[model samples]
Target: MTTVERTQVFLLPDLGEGLSEAEIVEWRVAVGDIVTVDQTVVEVETAKAVVDVPCPYAGRVVALHGAAGEIRPVGQPLITIAPLDGDGGAGDEPAGHATYREEERAGSGNVLIGYGTGHGGSGRRRRRPRLAVAGEPPAAVGTGAVAQTDPTGPADAAPAGTGVTASPGSSPALVISPIVRRLAKERGVDLASVRGTGLGGVIRRADVEAALADAAAPAARLAAVPDAPEAHVGLAPAGDGDVVIPLTGIRKAIADKLSRSRREIPEVTIWVDVDATALLETRAAINAATPDAPVSILALLARICLSGLRKYPQLNAHVDTEGQRIVQSAGVHLGIAAQTDRGLLVPVLRDAQRLTTRELAAELAATTAAARAGTLPPARLTGGTFTLNNYGVFGVDGSTPIINHPEAALLGVGRIVDKPWVVDGQLAVRKVTQLSLTFDHRVCDGGVAGGFLRHVADCVEQPALLVANV
Candidate 1:
């Protein structure tokens, strides 16, 4: 007697916000384990945020489509879940393995924008049928093959070249996902590069990704591209005497953004020295009176930035060079430059215009703390109309900061220290700091840019100008 069971493949849902791909940080379930609808099955990290992907179907976990740490694009199969029973189980077992049957492509009645589901609910659903060759054994179905059971694993222990070996006589690596194949093919990777890391030597998406990364490494790409410039740009292959660090993950993201900013934006910086004596005293007085929650220098600077933006709204905007447009924002989404263990991350405070000094301080503290802990969501890292960078924490006096792309301007504040100033026609020591503004010339001219910086300086010099408003 032949018994048939049906399974459903859950594609990774659009985690919202136009993100295309996410890395599989971890999986919460295993094969043969029961799961219910809306269960958190996996944690994925996109370019902007780390999100928990939920299982939309209730069934037994038949297979995990990708391994942990593998990057999967949108609409890719994340997991395969099968219905519990055709007749509630408790029946005679089949000989070796039940013939895997095909299922329709109707998603769990759940999907994100632009991929499978669309308007009118009539979007053509694409079915993915992962099947075993006719007469082929299905023992490898949903098999969670352990990584090379070596006496030689990828583990720290064990000598190299002593791990599990796939003899040429064995069947080609049991691959179930088309994504894995497509990835390898796109990168011109040989599927036989090594044994698959999946069940029964079934290759996982991670294996293919690793192959693609290895092929794209600087050492490997030397023969593919002209090497003269890259060598000067630190792209040369490492020698025995050299320790080469590859740009990857967050570092790679930073490199790409900085390069694009430097290449596309024609930037110019203007600086002014401000006597911060009054501002310092005002902040101290406020803190001394409150003692509960103190306003930060960043918060004060942010308040002044918003005020300055109000007078010169053009600086708080984005430049759409492709459209030949200067887009001015109605409100400020203030990005505070934060240096964290992960790297330099700019977390935006949405609609910062309406926030009071205390509230701004709280938000800045929270945002910076979250960034340091690497817990800030990806969405919070983007969409800024202006940026306030306090380089004083780094013990620097000023910087010609690169403008955060799309945004037209960045305000940099330097360390406030005792500096000689002419007061009442006499040389006096005063608390002074440097303020610099880097802007895209397309947005505004020097007259407007200078005015904005002058307004900030005026507020910093006469704290009452800003403190009263706060």
Candidate 2:
């Protein structure tokens, strides 16, 4: 008979995003799997994004408290581990020392920074651990580093708690969305004066618009100048006085998505010009009929593209890497490249082709609202058959949008501008918009992608052609 000692580990406070709960996306280590401290053990999805949680103590994984996709609360036992002893077999420890001494604990002390790694287990506790709380994964930290200590406390160990540290200041700096930051940078508006109405009092796109609107308020009551101070940090370079902007949260997400797309997918782009007179007129008519409906150019473009997707099934396809096959979708789930304050977010409209023009407009409005609010569910932002980016809204002529990886293609719609064209052998003014379609050339050849774009432009140019097909 063999005797062994087991210990339970509790979930820490700031898993990330200051969230109290998190959904377990995956368990990297299962029961009985040997795991070292600081190794990634599980992946969790919070409200904002997916993150990986690391092991707190170095030991053998004895148990997992929850299954994948299960919501767990913070300060609960996530996993139990069997600590290694002198008699512990000659198992494996990487080419490094594995020491277990009382060190500083997580979520203790002066202030809480964003979710990074925390301190360690206190005084060799052999108590039961709790489940993980609902929250984002702790922010990524450097390898094998412990949270710094609090000299004021006794040289023991920090006790188990939520592990989420709170901000020290009364009015901690306002949190601004990616879209708000972009608009502010472009328009030279101060974000400090803008009152945030978002979750956790975060600054939002609407807040920036409100601040811009109040720019003419009485000088005495005016809000303090925004972002200018940060911008003017240097007139002339001083002893390496560089500004350190932290990249975490939404900015981190944007970097990951773009990097993944470029690294994993082979992309090719094709461009064409489409007559937009009918599309514009059609939108105007729809708006007049339902004054309350927020019918915009996006709705018309989405409908046209959805129709084209049904006609060209190959364009509405996804690469199945494991299956080693191309999966042509039977239905169209269109992702609109929505530019928000916190960067680019693509909210999908499921079975888009099945919906009417008004429904498309309504879904677009709802999805965009959810995205900008940072309340969009992870599922709504995932699994798209195709994507559409309206560079036209920004008054841009044309652009080659990167293909959303896994999906075969993305369509970029340019701004509609008046141009002279031959009509009845005579030059006439016509509304024209350029369309740039970038696809994964590996999945679809240039001939097929080109034909698809040409067909889509034809539908937009003569929307009546769609009526004929229907």
- What RMSD, rounded to one decimal, does every model reach? 11.2, 14.3
lDDT of 1 by residue, 264-359 (tens): 888899999999999988899999999899999888899999999998999998888889898999989999999975578889999999888899
TM-scores of all models? 0.68, 0.55
Clash count, predicted structure 2: 28
Error of 1 at 364 (Å): 1.3
| Best by the TM-score measure | 1
User: Candidate 2's residue-wise lDDT over 1-470, tens digit each?
Assistant: 23233453535336543457666655555444455545556656554555566665565555566655356777666665555544553234333324541211121231111222543444232322222211212222212122122334332221222112212332322432333444544444544445568775666678766765674521111122354433322111222233333354455656767788888788988898877888888777878888997687888788878877777788899888888898999889899888875578887888998898888988998898878865565566778889999888999999877777678899998888999977779998999999999888767788888888888888887778877755
lDDT values, one for every candidate: 0.67, 0.62
